[model samples]
Target: MSAYPTDRQPTHTPVMLSEVLALLNVRRGGVYIDATVGLGGHAAAILEASAPDGRLLGLDADAQALAAARRRLEPFGERCRLEQAWLDHCAAAAARHGFSAVDGVLCDLGVSSLQLDDPQRGFSFQQDGPLDMRLGDAAEQTAADVVNYYEEADLADVIYRLGEERRSRRIARAIVERRPLETTGELAQIVQSAVGRGPRRRIHPATHVFRALRLEVNRELERLSGFLASARGLLAAGGRLVAIAFHSLEDRIVKRFIRAAGSGDDAGFRSLSKKVIRPSADEIQRNPRARSARLRAAEAV
Candidate 1:
């Protein structure tokens, strides 16, 4: 019974929803941030567990996403704060809301189910929609903009580096010749055509290309790097930070950041998790979307 429209196909399931509550160690009177809070599902649960005087601030770059979050968290009234902001700017957002030095932070670094399910949003290669892939309002370029604007070599670089597509040069050449791909389905077709005949299916040949486009459009990597550093600054002493990443590209960054922070030059923090925690078989079965989730936690001394 997902809330998203049927055509959009409910791709989000709040991965590791229960694990987020356990790791945050949430308690009464505590405050936390659900950075990249797509739908407010995890934030709502965190607020409930840390209830009485506990408050939760949920932030996301998409206004539409924020609108939906506001409704989902409305039951908590003033206990929940919803905003349209990137996680990297946590400190400034805190200052504006008269909040400071939270007891815990939760970041779920996965895209929302809404974005993927909505064919019009163009995040998925399954549907034939426009190439627009901007997550926030200020996105400078759409996927189409990137495809049509970048030179063949630049496009090759993007596909090669981000998508990990080995046949990047060939794909890029095909893309340039095709020129002005109008829709998500159209682009998928172009890539498919370039790929030629193959097995019936093998994870959608354009999967990597779509992933690279989404990450680039949202500036996810840069934001993640900044948020990791900024989150440390926004934590009170002994505070904890929990993050859930969905893919190797994201998990690798989270892993390195925790490793460095926990073993800083001055030993500023203690690593709560030496290894990643994954969802249980039951959780994965209930929400297949949780399959790729990797959870990591750390605490400020």
Candidate 2:
């Protein structure tokens, strides 16, 4: 009973939908904010679960994605408000929309399927397009800018730390030798050449490099940090904060944030998920993109 067409459905399945709903504990008359409401899939579900009186504030940096979300959420009328903004601006956006201290908040971190499926966004190595990997107009740099201009040492560091790639030095050396790379295909080829496809390799050799470049171009980690720092203050007592992270680095940050908030003598938060919730086998089979998703949730004290 999906609202999206069959062909477009696969591109934007809301990962762990049931889990998100359970974690947020959506209820009628509740106020919620979808910090990364790409395509409005989750927002629609939340509105339905909350029924007639619930309100949602949806935010996204990508204008096109925001526009799509607006259309998808139109049936809810004024109950859903869509905004084009980064997750780090969630607190401000919530305040502006009179959603301060909402009943629940959700932050789905990492790139969306909309961005990856669009070859023009350059988030995936599987598709050939411009090396531009900016998540939105707000990004000051692009994957091409980083690939064509960064020093070898800095590039290596970015690959190693952000991408978690062991052969970062080798990859960076290869990229430097082939300067002025203009497209994702060219960069993917260079990385693949430098890091040969191992017999047991299940993923593309350039996966890590592309991930690193996208993270750098969008300053994702920095913004996630900023969002986490401000998230608690925007929640009313007993309000839930749910975050779904797609990578280990992002998960680690969320895990640590929740852990710290629940530890002190004056602890102002409580862990709602004892361990991180991950997609079940059935969910993964239905939506392959859910494989790496990890959800962590906490409630304000």
Clashing residue pairs for model 1? 8-117, 12-113, 128-185
Per-residue CA lDDT of model 2 for 1-301, tens digit only, reads: 0123435633378989999999899999899999999989899999999999999999999886787788789999989998989889888888888888888999887777777787887888898989988877889998989988999999999999999999999999999999999989999999999999999999998999988998899899989989988888898999999999999999999999999989979776899989999999999998989999999999999
Q: Name the candidate that leads on TM-score.
A: 2
The TM-score that candidate 1 achieves is 0.93
* lDDT of all predictions: 0.82, 0.89
Superposed model 1: Cα runs more than 4 Å off: 1-12
Candidates' TM-scores? Answer: 0.93, 0.96
User: Which tens-of-lDDT digit does each residue in 5-26 have in candidate 1?
Assistant: 5343233567877667777888
- The alpha-carbon deviation from the true structure for residue 35 of candidate 2, after best TM-score superposition, in angstroms, is 0.2
